[model samples]
Target chain A: MVNDNILGIIAGILTSLAMLPQLLKVLKEKNVDDLSPLMLITLILGLSLWVWYGVFKRELPIIYSNAFAVLVNLSLLSCYFLYRKSG
Target chain B: MVNDNILGIIAGILTSLAMLPQLLKVLKEKNVDDLSPLMLITLILGLSLWVWYGVFKRELPIIYSNAFAVLVNLSLLSCYFLYRKSG
Candidate 1:
């Protein structure tokens, strides 16, 4: 990719891996009871909006990256729900 | 604010709060020994560059939100270091 496109790719990678620390923590602990469900929900909703914005602008970089980011967050959310102990 | 502006603000809030779940979990657990330090460092660097990009574009929403985000991540990193035990 070109130099300009490199930023987009970097952004994409950063955005996708941003949650790695939290996901790693959750997995190693085998519990996510303490993770904020509200925070994750807001992220999902907000990033969805960003994806829409990217579509409206016809910006492939933003759209593709945010789309992938959604999957990352969704996976963490799933683990959060799955491993959480009902209290 | 206009609808477009609302999106910017929403994006701002989400960008900042996106890390809340992880921070909350860290505080609750008082441990980030398992969390990916490399992940956090990369995020900080990437977002810093994003901040620079925002400045390059004179995009207040991106710059401002990401500036606050750096603070948020730094706080988390501090907590991570303070509470983490060497094992």
Candidate 2:
């Protein structure tokens, strides 16, 4: 049980922070042509759902990780639009 | 409880399949220059751990969803390598 909790925590941390690199890359390059807006939109929807699911289940790990993911993806999405518009 | 379960299922489906559009985009365009390999790697690692966490908890939804996510990310990672090498 303890091991499972640790695993969940680690997994949550990794997944939540996974997009940091991509966000940094886009910020550095200011290019969004190859990145798919549909993907980001779908992911954001999914992450939001996960947050709601977590709320229902009272799963803090799921809630926190996915909430953070939502924020990151939202930032990425905004960057996508911001950069795409300028070009 | 049933509503919560349903929410979890839907969330699982959405999050697990979120990368499909991105995968299709990569296949059609053969361009992953904007995608970050580190992000994919981190996501894959996280998904793998989610699978293990699910197994430990005997939660089928978590296991299946994360397993599928791992597959998607792995394919994305392979494409990243395949295209990055050629270009």
Candidate 3:
């Protein structure tokens, strides 16, 4: 059981932080034309739902991981709009 | 409990398929210069771990959702390489 929790936490961390590279790339390049807004919107919604699910299940890992994803995607989405036309 | 499971399933479906729009955009536009291969690679690795975690937990929703994400990301990653130089 302890191993399982550890695995879950690691998986959560990886998935939650997976978008950091993309965010960094966008920040450095300042180009967002190729990215689809729909993707970010959908992902944000999905992540929000995951947070809700976690809350209902009282699962801290799920809640925190998905909440973190939502924040990352939101920032990326903002960058998308900010740089959409410039790119 | 049943409601929680349903919520989880819905969340799984949304998150699992969240990349579809991005994938579709890449296919139609055939431009992937802005897409970070590192992002996809990391996400795929994380999603694979999610699948493993799910299997260990015997959670069907988690297993199938993350499995689907892995496939989608793999396809996206392939496109990233195929179109990297062109764009």
Can you give the DockQ of every candidate in the order shown? Answer: 0.45, 0.71, 0.65
CAPRI verdict (incorrect, acceptable, medium, high) for model 2: medium
Model 1 CA lDDT for position A46? 76
Clashing pairs in 1: none
**Winner by lDDT between candidate 2 and candidate 1:** 2
Displacement of the residue B82 alpha carbon in candidate 2, Å:
3.0
For residues B1-87, write the lDDT of model 3, one tens digit per residue.
Answer: 448678778888888677788788889998886677877788888888888877887877778888999998899999988888852
Between candidates 1 and 3, which one is better according to lDDT?
A: 3
Write out the backbone clash pairs for model 2: none
Residue A32 in model 2: lDDT: 79
Native contact recovery (fnat) for each candidate is: 0.38, 0.86, 0.76
- Rank candidates, TM-score, best first: 2, 3, 1
Listed per model in order, the count of residue pairs whose N, CA or C atoms clash below 3 Å is 0, 0, 0
Q: Against the true structure, what is each candidate's TM-score? A: 0.78, 0.85, 0.83
TM-score of candidate 1 versus the correct structure, residues matched by position: 0.78
On residues A1-84, what C-alpha lDDT tens digit does candidate 2 reach at each position? Answer: 458778879999998788688788888999876577887888889889888877876777778888999999899899998999
